[model samples]
Target: MIITDTHTHLYSNEFDEDRNEMIQRAIDAGVSRFFIPAIDSAYTHSMYDLEKAYPNTIFLMMGLHPTHVKDNYLEELQHVETELSKRKFYAIGEIGIDLYWDKTHLPEQQDSFRKQIQLAKQYKLPIVIHCREAFDEIFEILEEEKSPDLFGIFHCFTGNYEQALQAISYNMKLGIGGVVTFKNGKIDQFLNQIDLKHIVLETDSPYLAPIPLRGKRNESSYILNVVDKLSEIYNLSNEEIASITTENSKVVFGI
Candidate 1:
């Protein structure tokens, strides 16, 4: 059973001490593919180092995260463009509007989101979105940018059935993560209603750890907890769930 973690920060400092061990742990747990999301220029080198370390397992995306859309966002976007020109990237993502932290940068966040969407279209790459407390806002831009070329995954999706439909309408596969295993995470309630094809697995590790390990730092290995939960929700075996979601991930990432 080859599982795919479509979104994870394997390069995050959280795993600095046992990075290799943690990754190997996940690999042993059947997670062979790890799609790494870009935060900002600050972590670019670490991301590259991670790719070099696990060239086959680590896939990279380049973009400025919404939360990191500060004053110098233009320069960061330039860096994204430069990197895209230099080499191949699976996607342009972990980008979108994040109003939970601070609404002061909403305008800049929206602008950055739209610009990055454009960049994704230009490069013919799927986008990985990082939306928080801004589903309406994110959907607004997605509506304006809707096109055959505008497609991606809604990373860490935490919206309702209606919003899920809206995201699907825009060619986005909902990224299911540890939240699906939480007792009150809510997405689990209607997940089966959305076909398995519209779903992909993620851990967002070092964050949103599934129950049994909830409130603690998460790792990709814990994604099995998520797969087990999804098994119950979709009424499929764990291997089937993993196989379908990993295949769905390939559809979105084109890997």
Candidate 2:
């Protein structure tokens, strides 16, 4: 069962003491590929270091996260452009409107999201979104920028069935993660309605740990927990769920 954690922050300081061991735990649990998303210029080196440490399994995305769209956003976006010009990246992401953090930067967040989507199209790369309490805001920009070239994952998707359909219409796959196991994580109620082709598994580690580990620090190894939950949601075996979702991730990340 080759599970793919399409969105994770393995480079995060959360695992500083046992990063390799933590990653190995995931590997042992059959979670192999990890797609790391960029937050801003600040974590660039750490991300690169992680790539070097796990060249065979780690893929990176470059972008300015919406929460980071502060006063220095223009400069940050410039950094994203510069990095893209220098080398290859799997996607431009973890970018989108995040009203949950602060509403003051809504305008800047929307602009950054649109500009980065253009960048993704320029490079013919996928995008990984990080939306929170801004579905309508994010959808507005996606609507204006909708095109064959505009496509990616709706990371940590926690919307209704209609919103799921709306995101799919825009060529996006819904990123499922720890939330699928929550008692109140509503996505599970209708997730079966969306085909496995439009679904990809993720851990979003150091955050959103599923089930028994809920509210605790999450790691890639816990992706098995997600797989376990997916099996129930999709009415398939764990290996089958892994196979389907991993293949779905390939469709999005082009891995």
lDDT of 2 by residue, 118-222 (tens): 999999998888899999998998999999988899999999999999999999999999999999999999999999899999999989999999999999999
Clashes of 2: 0
Q: What TM-score quantifies how close candidate 1 is to the native fold?
A: 0.99
lDDT of 1 at 226: 93
lDDT of 1 by residue, 105-193 (tens): 99999999999999999999999999999998998999999999998899999999999999999999999999888888899899889
Q: How displaced is residue 170 in candidate 2, in Å?
A: 0.5
Q: Rate the local accuracy (lDDT) of all candidates.
A: 0.94, 0.93
Q: Indicate the residue-level lDDT of 223 in model 1.
A: 96
TM-score of each: 0.99, 0.99
Among the numbered candidates, top lDDT falls to: 1
User: Which 10 successive residues of model 1 have the least lDDT summed?
Assistant: 179-188
